[model samples]
Target: MRLSIPIQSHYYERKRIMRLFEAKNLTKKYDKTVLDHLDFSINEGEVVGVIGVSGCGKSTLARLVSGIEKPSSGSLLYQGKPVDFKKGRKDIQLILQNSIESFSPRMKIRVFLYEPYHYFYHLHKNEALDCIKKILKQVGMDESCLEKYPHELSGGQLQRIAIARALIIHPRLLICDEITSSLDHVVQREIIELLKKFVEKNHISILFISHDLSLVHEFCHQVLVLNNGKIIEKGTIQQLYKSENEVVQNLLKAAYLNS
Candidate 1:
Protein backbone atom coordinates (compact mmCIF):
# COMPACT_ATOMS: atom_id res chain seq x y z
CA MET A 1 0.00 0.00 0.00
CA ARG A 2 1.08 3.58 -0.62
CA LEU A 3 1.61 6.17 2.12
CA SER A 4 -1.35 8.23 3.31
CA ILE A 5 -1.07 11.25 5.61
CA PRO A 6 -2.14 13.82 8.23
CA ILE A 7 0.32 12.04 10.53
CA GLN A 8 -1.39 13.43 13.60
CA SER A 9 1.61 15.69 13.44
CA HIS A 10 2.56 18.55 15.82
CA TYR A 11 2.46 22.22 14.87
CA TYR A 12 5.11 24.47 16.42
CA GLU A 13 4.73 27.62 18.55
CA ARG A 14 5.80 30.44 16.27
CA LYS A 15 2.30 31.42 15.20
CA ARG A 16 0.44 30.24 18.35
CA ILE A 17 -2.40 29.05 16.13
CA MET A 18 -4.40 25.88 16.56
CA ARG A 19 -3.22 22.71 14.86
CA LEU A 20 -5.04 21.35 11.88
CA PHE A 21 -3.57 17.91 12.71
CA GLU A 22 -1.56 17.09 15.77
CA ALA A 23 0.08 13.86 16.91
CA LYS A 24 0.49 13.53 20.65
CA ASN A 25 2.94 10.96 22.05
CA LEU A 26 2.61 8.95 18.86
CA THR A 27 4.33 5.59 18.95
CA LYS A 28 4.35 2.66 16.55
CA LYS A 29 6.26 -0.58 16.71
CA TYR A 30 6.87 -3.19 14.05
CA ASP A 31 9.64 -5.68 14.89
CA LYS A 32 11.04 -2.81 16.92
CA THR A 33 10.30 0.78 17.73
CA VAL A 34 9.35 2.66 14.58
CA LEU A 35 8.00 5.82 16.14
CA ASP A 36 8.70 6.82 19.74
CA HIS A 37 6.41 9.43 21.12
CA LEU A 38 6.96 11.58 18.08
CA ASP A 39 5.38 15.01 18.00
CA PHE A 40 4.68 17.56 15.25
CA SER A 41 1.82 19.54 13.75
CA ILE A 42 0.56 21.23 10.63
CA ASN A 43 -1.37 24.47 10.75
CA GLU A 44 -4.01 25.43 8.22
CA GLY A 45 -2.54 26.32 4.84
CA GLU A 46 0.95 25.39 5.96
CA VAL A 47 3.50 23.15 4.24
CA VAL A 48 5.45 21.11 6.80
CA GLY A 49 8.31 19.00 5.53
CA VAL A 50 9.67 15.85 7.14
CA ILE A 51 13.24 14.93 6.15
CA GLY A 52 14.98 11.78 7.22
CA VAL A 53 17.06 8.85 6.09
CA SER A 54 15.45 5.79 4.58
CA GLY A 55 13.59 3.41 6.93
CA CYS A 56 13.47 6.07 9.60
CA GLY A 57 9.69 5.74 10.22
CA LYS A 58 8.69 8.51 7.82
CA SER A 59 6.42 6.18 5.91
CA THR A 60 5.02 4.77 9.14
CA LEU A 61 4.03 8.23 10.33
CA ALA A 62 2.35 8.94 7.01
CA ARG A 63 0.33 5.72 7.23
CA LEU A 64 -0.86 6.55 10.74
CA VAL A 65 -1.90 10.07 9.83
CA SER A 66 -3.74 8.95 6.72
CA GLY A 67 -5.61 6.26 8.67
CA ILE A 68 -4.08 3.48 6.60
CA GLU A 69 -2.62 2.41 9.95
CA LYS A 70 -3.42 3.43 13.51
CA PRO A 71 -1.01 4.68 16.13
CA SER A 72 0.00 2.09 18.71
CA SER A 73 -0.16 4.39 21.76
CA GLY A 74 -0.98 7.93 20.86
CA SER A 75 -3.76 10.28 19.91
CA LEU A 76 -4.31 11.91 16.54
CA LEU A 77 -6.49 14.95 16.85
CA TYR A 78 -8.04 17.01 14.10
CA GLN A 79 -9.63 20.32 15.10
CA GLY A 80 -9.62 19.34 18.82
CA LYS A 81 -11.51 16.07 18.27
CA PRO A 82 -10.37 12.51 17.74
CA VAL A 83 -9.95 12.05 13.99
CA ASP A 84 -12.51 9.80 12.45
CA PHE A 85 -10.74 7.94 9.67
CA LYS A 86 -14.06 7.05 8.09
CA LYS A 87 -15.04 10.68 7.53
CA GLY A 88 -11.60 12.24 7.94
CA ARG A 89 -10.33 10.48 4.86
CA LYS A 90 -12.48 12.70 2.68
CA ASP A 91 -10.62 15.74 3.91
CA ILE A 92 -7.16 14.11 3.63
CA GLN A 93 -5.50 12.94 0.42
CA LEU A 94 -2.23 11.10 -0.02
CA ILE A 95 0.14 10.91 -3.00
CA LEU A 96 2.72 8.17 -2.78
CA GLN A 97 6.16 7.87 -4.29
CA ASN A 98 5.34 4.98 -6.58
CA SER A 99 3.35 6.29 -9.52
CA ILE A 100 3.63 2.98 -11.37
CA GLU A 101 1.64 0.95 -8.86
CA SER A 102 -0.58 3.87 -7.84
CA PHE A 103 -3.49 2.54 -9.86
CA SER A 104 -4.98 -0.75 -10.89
CA PRO A 105 -3.60 -2.29 -14.06
CA ARG A 106 -7.09 -3.02 -15.30
CA MET A 107 -8.43 0.49 -14.81
CA LYS A 108 -8.31 3.30 -17.31
CA ILE A 109 -7.43 6.87 -16.38
CA ARG A 110 -11.09 7.80 -16.65
CA VAL A 111 -12.28 5.25 -14.10
CA PHE A 112 -9.52 6.10 -11.70
CA LEU A 113 -10.27 9.80 -11.71
CA TYR A 114 -14.04 9.35 -11.56
CA GLU A 115 -14.04 6.99 -8.56
CA PRO A 116 -13.31 9.72 -5.99
CA TYR A 117 -15.86 12.05 -7.47
CA HIS A 118 -18.54 9.40 -7.38
CA TYR A 119 -17.60 8.08 -3.97
CA PHE A 120 -17.19 11.36 -2.13
CA TYR A 121 -19.44 13.81 -3.93
CA HIS A 122 -21.75 11.38 -5.70
CA LEU A 123 -21.13 13.40 -8.81
CA HIS A 124 -22.57 12.05 -12.01
CA LYS A 125 -20.26 11.10 -14.85
CA ASN A 126 -20.79 14.35 -16.71
CA GLU A 127 -20.12 16.52 -13.66
CA ALA A 128 -17.06 14.53 -12.68
CA LEU A 129 -15.78 14.72 -16.23
CA ASP A 130 -15.94 18.48 -16.18
CA CYS A 131 -13.96 18.69 -12.95
CA ILE A 132 -11.47 16.07 -14.16
CA LYS A 133 -10.94 18.01 -17.35
CA LYS A 134 -10.07 21.14 -15.40
CA ILE A 135 -7.81 19.26 -12.98
CA LEU A 136 -6.06 17.40 -15.77
CA LYS A 137 -5.26 20.69 -17.44
CA GLN A 138 -4.07 22.13 -14.15
CA VAL A 139 -1.66 19.23 -13.70
CA GLY A 140 -0.46 19.73 -17.28
CA MET A 141 -2.50 16.95 -18.83
CA ASP A 142 -5.65 16.68 -20.96
CA GLU A 143 -8.57 14.35 -21.71
CA SER A 144 -6.89 12.36 -24.45
CA CYS A 145 -5.47 9.85 -21.96
CA LEU A 146 -8.84 9.06 -20.45
CA GLU A 147 -9.06 5.79 -22.32
CA LYS A 148 -5.55 4.63 -21.54
CA TYR A 149 -4.36 2.44 -18.66
CA PRO A 150 -1.52 3.38 -16.31
CA HIS A 151 1.00 1.48 -18.43
CA GLU A 152 0.42 3.68 -21.45
CA LEU A 153 1.80 6.82 -19.78
CA SER A 154 5.29 7.95 -18.90
CA GLY A 155 6.40 8.12 -15.24
CA GLY A 156 6.01 11.86 -15.15
CA GLN A 157 2.57 11.70 -16.75
CA LEU A 158 1.35 9.10 -14.27
CA GLN A 159 2.64 11.12 -11.36
CA ARG A 160 0.94 14.24 -12.60
CA ILE A 161 -2.26 12.34 -13.08
CA ALA A 162 -1.93 10.93 -9.58
CA ILE A 163 -1.67 14.43 -8.22
CA ALA A 164 -4.69 15.53 -10.24
CA ARG A 165 -6.65 12.58 -8.89
CA ALA A 166 -5.85 13.50 -5.28
CA LEU A 167 -6.75 17.16 -5.68
CA ILE A 168 -10.03 16.38 -7.44
CA ILE A 169 -11.79 15.76 -4.11
CA HIS A 170 -10.46 19.03 -2.66
CA PRO A 171 -8.79 17.67 0.46
CA ARG A 172 -7.82 20.12 3.21
CA LEU A 173 -4.60 18.18 3.89
CA LEU A 174 -2.26 16.63 1.30
CA ILE A 175 0.28 14.05 2.37
CA CYS A 176 3.19 13.62 -0.02
CA ASP A 177 5.55 10.69 0.52
CA GLU A 178 8.62 10.99 -1.63
CA ILE A 179 6.34 11.83 -4.58
CA THR A 180 9.21 13.36 -6.54
CA SER A 181 11.84 10.76 -5.71
CA SER A 182 11.22 8.70 -8.84
CA LEU A 183 10.97 11.59 -11.30
CA ASP A 184 13.73 13.44 -13.03
CA HIS A 185 14.76 16.87 -11.79
CA VAL A 186 12.75 18.63 -14.48
CA VAL A 187 9.58 16.65 -13.81
CA GLN A 188 10.09 17.19 -10.09
CA ARG A 189 10.22 20.96 -10.57
CA GLU A 190 7.09 20.90 -12.72
CA ILE A 191 5.17 18.93 -10.08
CA ILE A 192 6.41 21.17 -7.27
CA GLU A 193 5.40 24.24 -9.25
CA LEU A 194 1.95 22.78 -9.79
CA LEU A 195 1.63 22.10 -6.05
CA LYS A 196 2.80 25.61 -5.26
CA LYS A 197 0.16 27.09 -7.52
CA PHE A 198 -2.56 24.94 -6.04
CA VAL A 199 -1.52 25.80 -2.47
CA GLU A 200 -1.53 29.50 -3.34
CA LYS A 201 -5.06 29.19 -4.65
CA ASN A 202 -6.45 26.78 -2.03
CA HIS A 203 -6.39 26.75 1.75
CA ILE A 204 -4.76 23.30 1.94
CA SER A 205 -2.19 22.05 4.44
CA ILE A 206 0.63 19.75 3.30
CA LEU A 207 2.87 17.24 5.04
CA PHE A 208 5.81 16.70 2.72
CA ILE A 209 8.15 13.75 3.41
CA SER A 210 11.36 13.47 1.45
CA HIS A 211 14.95 12.28 1.51
CA ASP A 212 15.97 15.14 -0.72
CA LEU A 213 16.85 18.07 1.49
CA SER A 214 17.23 20.41 -1.45
CA LEU A 215 13.74 19.73 -2.73
CA VAL A 216 12.22 20.10 0.75
CA HIS A 217 14.12 23.33 1.28
CA GLU A 218 12.82 24.71 -1.98
CA PHE A 219 9.19 23.75 -1.35
CA CYS A 220 8.44 23.67 2.40
CA HIS A 221 7.91 26.69 4.66
CA GLN A 222 9.17 24.78 7.73
CA VAL A 223 10.92 21.44 8.18
CA LEU A 224 11.58 18.74 10.77
CA VAL A 225 14.63 16.52 10.65
CA LEU A 226 13.50 13.05 11.68
CA ASN A 227 15.88 10.64 13.37
CA ASN A 228 15.27 7.49 15.39
CA GLY A 229 11.53 8.16 15.30
CA LYS A 230 11.83 11.63 16.80
CA ILE A 231 12.27 15.12 15.36
CA ILE A 232 15.89 16.02 16.04
CA GLU A 233 15.71 19.41 14.46
CA LYS A 234 12.91 21.69 13.30
CA GLY A 235 13.03 25.11 11.65
CA THR A 236 13.15 27.04 8.41
CA ILE A 237 15.71 26.16 5.75
CA GLN A 238 18.03 28.98 6.73
CA GLN A 239 17.69 28.22 10.40
CA LEU A 240 18.40 24.54 9.87
CA TYR A 241 21.64 25.32 8.12
CA LYS A 242 22.79 27.02 11.26
CA SER A 243 21.93 24.05 13.50
CA GLU A 244 24.67 23.16 15.97
CA ASN A 245 23.52 19.58 16.38
CA GLU A 246 26.01 17.15 14.93
CA VAL A 247 23.45 14.93 13.31
CA VAL A 248 21.83 17.90 11.63
CA GLN A 249 25.20 19.25 10.60
CA ASN A 250 26.31 15.98 9.03
CA LEU A 251 22.99 15.52 7.28
CA LEU A 252 23.21 18.99 5.77
CA LYS A 253 26.73 18.28 4.56
CA ALA A 254 25.78 15.00 2.95
CA ALA A 255 22.60 16.25 1.35
CA TYR A 256 24.20 19.31 -0.20
CA LEU A 257 27.29 17.41 -1.31
CA ASN A 258 25.16 14.80 -3.06
CA SER A 259 23.01 17.52 -4.58
Candidate 2:
Protein backbone atom coordinates (compact mmCIF):
# COMPACT_ATOMS: atom_id res chain seq x y z
CA MET A 1 0.00 0.00 0.00
CA ARG A 2 3.06 2.26 0.18
CA LEU A 3 3.85 2.99 -3.41
CA SER A 4 4.85 6.42 -4.73
CA ILE A 5 5.03 6.84 -8.48
CA PRO A 6 5.64 10.30 -9.92
CA ILE A 7 2.66 12.19 -11.37
CA GLN A 8 2.71 11.38 -15.09
CA SER A 9 -0.66 12.81 -16.17
CA HIS A 10 -0.83 15.13 -19.19
CA TYR A 11 -3.85 17.00 -17.72
CA TYR A 12 -1.66 19.48 -15.86
CA GLU A 13 -0.19 20.97 -19.03
CA ARG A 14 -3.48 21.90 -20.66
CA LYS A 15 -3.97 25.69 -20.77
CA ARG A 16 -6.76 26.16 -23.25
CA ILE A 17 -9.58 24.26 -21.55
CA MET A 18 -11.14 25.75 -18.43
CA ARG A 19 -10.92 23.64 -15.29
CA LEU A 20 -14.17 22.97 -13.47
CA PHE A 21 -12.66 21.51 -10.33
CA GLU A 22 -9.06 21.33 -9.16
CA ALA A 23 -7.52 19.80 -6.05
CA LYS A 24 -3.95 20.51 -5.00
CA ASN A 25 -2.11 18.80 -2.14
CA LEU A 26 -5.51 17.67 -0.88
CA THR A 27 -5.43 15.65 2.31
CA LYS A 28 -8.11 14.45 4.77
CA LYS A 29 -7.84 12.71 8.13
CA TYR A 30 -9.69 11.71 11.28
CA ASP A 31 -7.94 9.31 13.67
CA LYS A 32 -5.51 8.66 10.81
CA THR A 33 -4.93 10.09 7.36
CA VAL A 34 -7.54 8.55 5.09
CA LEU A 35 -6.45 10.62 2.11
CA ASP A 36 -2.88 11.78 1.69
CA HIS A 37 -1.73 14.77 -0.35
CA LEU A 38 -3.38 14.39 -3.77
CA ASP A 39 -3.63 16.59 -6.84
CA PHE A 40 -6.04 16.35 -9.77
CA SER A 41 -8.23 18.58 -11.95
CA ILE A 42 -11.49 17.98 -13.77
CA ASN A 43 -12.15 20.17 -16.79
CA GLU A 44 -15.44 21.67 -17.89
CA GLY A 45 -17.77 19.26 -19.69
CA GLU A 46 -15.33 16.46 -18.93
CA VAL A 47 -16.07 13.12 -17.32
CA VAL A 48 -13.14 12.11 -15.11
CA GLY A 49 -13.07 8.60 -13.66
CA VAL A 50 -11.35 7.74 -10.38
CA ILE A 51 -10.51 4.08 -9.68
CA GLY A 52 -8.99 2.47 -6.62
CA VAL A 53 -9.38 -0.35 -4.11
CA SER A 54 -11.91 -0.16 -1.26
CA GLY A 55 -11.19 2.47 1.45
CA CYS A 56 -8.53 3.99 -0.75
CA GLY A 57 -10.22 7.43 -0.23
CA LYS A 58 -12.34 7.39 -3.40
CA SER A 59 -15.52 8.39 -1.55
CA THR A 60 -13.59 10.78 0.67
CA LEU A 61 -12.25 12.56 -2.37
CA ALA A 62 -15.78 12.88 -3.73
CA ARG A 63 -16.94 14.40 -0.43
CA LEU A 64 -14.11 16.89 -0.47
CA VAL A 65 -14.93 18.03 -3.99
CA SER A 66 -18.63 18.34 -3.24
CA GLY A 67 -17.84 20.26 -0.03
CA ILE A 68 -19.55 17.63 2.14
CA GLU A 69 -16.19 17.30 3.93
CA LYS A 70 -13.25 19.67 4.12
CA PRO A 71 -9.64 18.72 3.57
CA SER A 72 -7.36 18.84 6.59
CA SER A 73 -4.94 20.70 4.32
CA GLY A 74 -4.64 21.99 0.75
CA SER A 75 -7.44 23.47 -1.33
CA LEU A 76 -10.28 22.73 -3.76
CA LEU A 77 -10.98 25.35 -6.40
CA TYR A 78 -14.10 25.60 -8.49
CA GLN A 79 -13.80 27.73 -11.61
CA GLY A 80 -10.35 28.99 -10.54
CA LYS A 81 -11.54 30.28 -7.14
CA PRO A 82 -11.67 28.67 -3.70
CA VAL A 83 -14.87 26.63 -3.34
CA ASP A 84 -17.34 28.72 -1.36
CA PHE A 85 -19.92 26.18 -0.28
CA LYS A 86 -21.93 28.66 1.76
CA LYS A 87 -22.93 31.02 -1.02
CA GLY A 88 -22.76 28.63 -3.96
CA ARG A 89 -23.84 25.23 -2.69
CA LYS A 90 -26.24 24.66 -5.53
CA ASP A 91 -23.42 24.71 -8.09
CA ILE A 92 -22.12 21.36 -6.79
CA GLN A 93 -24.16 18.22 -6.22
CA LEU A 94 -23.35 14.68 -5.06
CA ILE A 95 -25.19 11.39 -5.55
CA LEU A 96 -24.18 8.08 -4.01
CA GLN A 97 -24.67 4.38 -4.86
CA ASN A 98 -27.41 3.90 -2.26
CA SER A 99 -30.08 5.79 -4.13
CA ILE A 100 -32.94 4.68 -1.92
CA GLU A 101 -31.40 6.19 1.19
CA SER A 102 -31.29 9.58 -0.49
CA PHE A 103 -35.05 9.92 -0.34
CA SER A 104 -37.58 9.86 2.46
CA PRO A 105 -39.95 6.90 2.82
CA ARG A 106 -42.67 9.18 4.09
CA MET A 107 -42.66 11.30 0.96
CA LYS A 108 -43.95 10.45 -2.48
CA ILE A 109 -41.68 10.73 -5.49
CA ARG A 110 -43.13 14.14 -6.35
CA VAL A 111 -42.47 15.46 -2.87
CA PHE A 112 -38.88 14.30 -2.97
CA LEU A 113 -38.38 15.79 -6.41
CA TYR A 114 -39.95 19.08 -5.34
CA GLU A 115 -37.19 19.84 -2.84
CA PRO A 116 -34.53 21.31 -5.14
CA TYR A 117 -36.97 23.65 -6.81
CA HIS A 118 -38.33 24.83 -3.50
CA TYR A 119 -34.92 25.22 -1.91
CA PHE A 120 -33.06 26.68 -4.83
CA TYR A 121 -35.72 28.51 -6.78
CA HIS A 122 -38.27 29.04 -4.02
CA LEU A 123 -41.03 27.80 -6.29
CA HIS A 124 -44.51 27.09 -4.91
CA LYS A 125 -45.80 23.50 -4.81
CA ASN A 126 -47.66 23.80 -8.08
CA GLU A 127 -44.75 25.55 -9.74
CA ALA A 128 -42.28 23.04 -8.30
CA LEU A 129 -44.22 20.03 -9.56
CA ASP A 130 -44.43 21.67 -12.97
CA CYS A 131 -40.66 21.92 -13.16
CA ILE A 132 -40.19 18.48 -11.62
CA LYS A 133 -42.39 16.89 -14.27
CA LYS A 134 -40.30 18.48 -16.99
CA ILE A 135 -37.03 17.31 -15.46
CA LEU A 136 -38.39 13.77 -14.96
CA LYS A 137 -38.88 13.57 -18.71
CA GLN A 138 -35.21 14.38 -19.18
CA VAL A 139 -34.35 11.45 -16.93
CA GLY A 140 -36.74 9.15 -18.82
CA MET A 141 -39.50 9.05 -16.20
CA ASP A 142 -43.09 10.24 -16.01
CA GLU A 143 -45.93 11.41 -13.77
CA SER A 144 -46.73 7.86 -12.60
CA CYS A 145 -43.36 7.77 -10.86
CA LEU A 146 -44.32 10.86 -8.90
CA GLU A 147 -46.90 9.03 -6.82
CA LYS A 148 -44.76 6.11 -5.77
CA TYR A 149 -42.74 5.88 -2.57
CA PRO A 150 -39.03 5.06 -2.51
CA HIS A 151 -39.78 1.54 -1.30
CA GLU A 152 -42.18 0.90 -4.17
CA LEU A 153 -39.64 1.36 -6.98
CA SER A 154 -36.90 -0.95 -8.17
CA GLY A 155 -33.26 -0.01 -7.61
CA GLY A 156 -32.75 1.12 -11.19
CA GLN A 157 -35.92 3.19 -11.20
CA LEU A 158 -35.04 4.96 -7.97
CA GLN A 159 -31.51 5.65 -9.13
CA ARG A 160 -32.85 7.38 -12.19
CA ILE A 161 -35.20 9.37 -10.00
CA ALA A 162 -32.27 10.43 -7.83
CA ILE A 163 -30.46 11.54 -10.96
CA ALA A 164 -33.48 13.54 -12.00
CA ARG A 165 -33.57 15.20 -8.62
CA ALA A 166 -29.91 16.14 -8.79
CA LEU A 167 -30.02 17.38 -12.36
CA ILE A 168 -33.16 19.39 -11.65
CA ILE A 169 -30.89 21.84 -9.87
CA HIS A 170 -28.62 22.20 -12.91
CA PRO A 171 -25.49 21.84 -10.81
CA ARG A 172 -22.28 22.73 -12.60
CA LEU A 173 -20.48 19.72 -11.11
CA LEU A 174 -21.87 16.28 -10.27
CA ILE A 175 -19.99 13.86 -8.05
CA CYS A 176 -21.23 10.38 -8.86
CA ASP A 177 -19.83 7.89 -6.34
CA GLU A 178 -20.29 4.26 -7.45
CA ILE A 179 -23.76 5.29 -8.65
CA THR A 180 -24.19 2.39 -11.07
CA SER A 181 -22.29 -0.43 -9.36
CA SER A 182 -25.24 -1.95 -7.53
CA LEU A 183 -27.57 -2.02 -10.53
CA ASP A 184 -27.78 -4.74 -13.16
CA HIS A 185 -25.55 -4.23 -16.19
CA VAL A 186 -28.34 -3.17 -18.54
CA VAL A 187 -29.68 -0.55 -16.13
CA GLN A 188 -26.16 0.71 -15.52
CA ARG A 189 -25.68 1.35 -19.23
CA GLU A 190 -29.05 3.08 -19.44
CA ILE A 191 -28.16 5.47 -16.62
CA ILE A 192 -24.82 6.26 -18.18
CA GLU A 193 -26.47 6.87 -21.54
CA LEU A 194 -28.92 9.27 -19.93
CA LEU A 195 -26.00 11.15 -18.40
CA LYS A 196 -24.23 11.20 -21.76
CA LYS A 197 -27.20 12.88 -23.39
CA PHE A 198 -27.42 15.42 -20.59
CA VAL A 199 -23.73 16.28 -20.94
CA GLU A 200 -24.08 16.69 -24.70
CA LYS A 201 -26.37 19.66 -24.19
CA ASN A 202 -25.19 21.05 -20.84
CA HIS A 203 -21.92 22.54 -19.62
CA ILE A 204 -21.87 20.23 -16.58
CA SER A 205 -18.84 18.15 -15.60
CA ILE A 206 -18.83 14.88 -13.68
CA LEU A 207 -16.36 13.25 -11.32
CA PHE A 208 -17.37 9.63 -11.87
CA ILE A 209 -15.87 7.43 -9.12
CA SER A 210 -16.13 3.69 -9.46
CA HIS A 211 -14.27 0.37 -9.15
CA ASP A 212 -15.63 -0.72 -12.55
CA LEU A 213 -12.51 -0.19 -14.63
CA SER A 214 -14.18 -1.25 -17.86
CA LEU A 215 -16.93 1.34 -17.43
CA VAL A 216 -14.36 3.95 -16.46
CA HIS A 217 -12.28 3.17 -19.53
CA GLU A 218 -15.30 3.45 -21.76
CA PHE A 219 -17.05 6.47 -20.22
CA CYS A 220 -14.41 8.86 -18.90
CA HIS A 221 -12.37 11.32 -20.97
CA GLN A 222 -9.46 10.65 -18.63
CA VAL A 223 -8.80 8.01 -15.94
CA LEU A 224 -6.88 8.37 -12.69
CA VAL A 225 -5.45 5.36 -10.82
CA LEU A 226 -5.57 6.06 -7.06
CA ASN A 227 -3.54 3.95 -4.64
CA ASN A 228 -2.49 4.60 -1.05
CA GLY A 229 -4.42 7.89 -1.21
CA LYS A 230 -2.43 9.26 -4.14
CA ILE A 231 -2.77 9.32 -7.94
CA ILE A 232 0.09 7.06 -9.02
CA GLU A 233 -0.88 7.16 -12.68
CA LYS A 234 -3.32 8.91 -15.00
CA GLY A 235 -4.02 8.88 -18.73
CA THR A 236 -6.55 7.79 -21.30
CA ILE A 237 -7.57 4.17 -20.82
CA GLN A 238 -5.51 3.09 -23.83
CA GLN A 239 -2.43 4.83 -22.46
CA LEU A 240 -2.94 3.41 -18.95
CA TYR A 241 -2.97 -0.07 -20.47
CA LYS A 242 0.58 0.49 -21.75
CA SER A 243 1.81 1.90 -18.42
CA GLU A 244 5.08 0.41 -17.16
CA ASN A 245 4.26 1.05 -13.47
CA GLU A 246 3.78 -2.25 -11.61
CA VAL A 247 1.08 -0.76 -9.34
CA VAL A 248 -1.06 0.28 -12.26
CA GLN A 249 -0.48 -3.08 -13.96
CA ASN A 250 -1.51 -5.01 -10.86
CA LEU A 251 -4.67 -2.95 -10.44
CA LEU A 252 -5.59 -3.50 -14.07
CA LYS A 253 -4.91 -7.24 -13.77
CA ALA A 254 -7.05 -7.56 -10.65
CA ALA A 255 -9.91 -5.65 -12.27
CA TYR A 256 -9.65 -7.87 -15.36
CA LEU A 257 -9.81 -10.99 -13.22
CA ASN A 258 -12.80 -9.74 -11.24
CA SER A 259 -14.69 -8.57 -14.30
Error of 2 at 5 (Å): 28
Error of 1 at 106 (Å): 1.3
Q: Among all windows of ten consecutive residues in candidate 2, which has the lowest summed lDDT?
A: 1-10
Global lDDT scores for all candidate models: 0.85, 0.85
lDDT value for candidate 2?
Answer: 0.85
Q: lDDT per residue, candidate 2, 94-186, as tens digits?
A: 999999888888899988988888888899999787788788888888789889999999999999999998898889889999999999888
- Where is model 1 more than 4 Å wrong at Cα? 1-18
Regions of model 2 farther than 4 Å from truth:
1-16
Candidate 1: minimum summed lDDT over ten consecutive residues — where?
A: 1-10
Q: How far is candidate 1 from the true structure (C-alpha RMSD, Å)?
A: 5.5
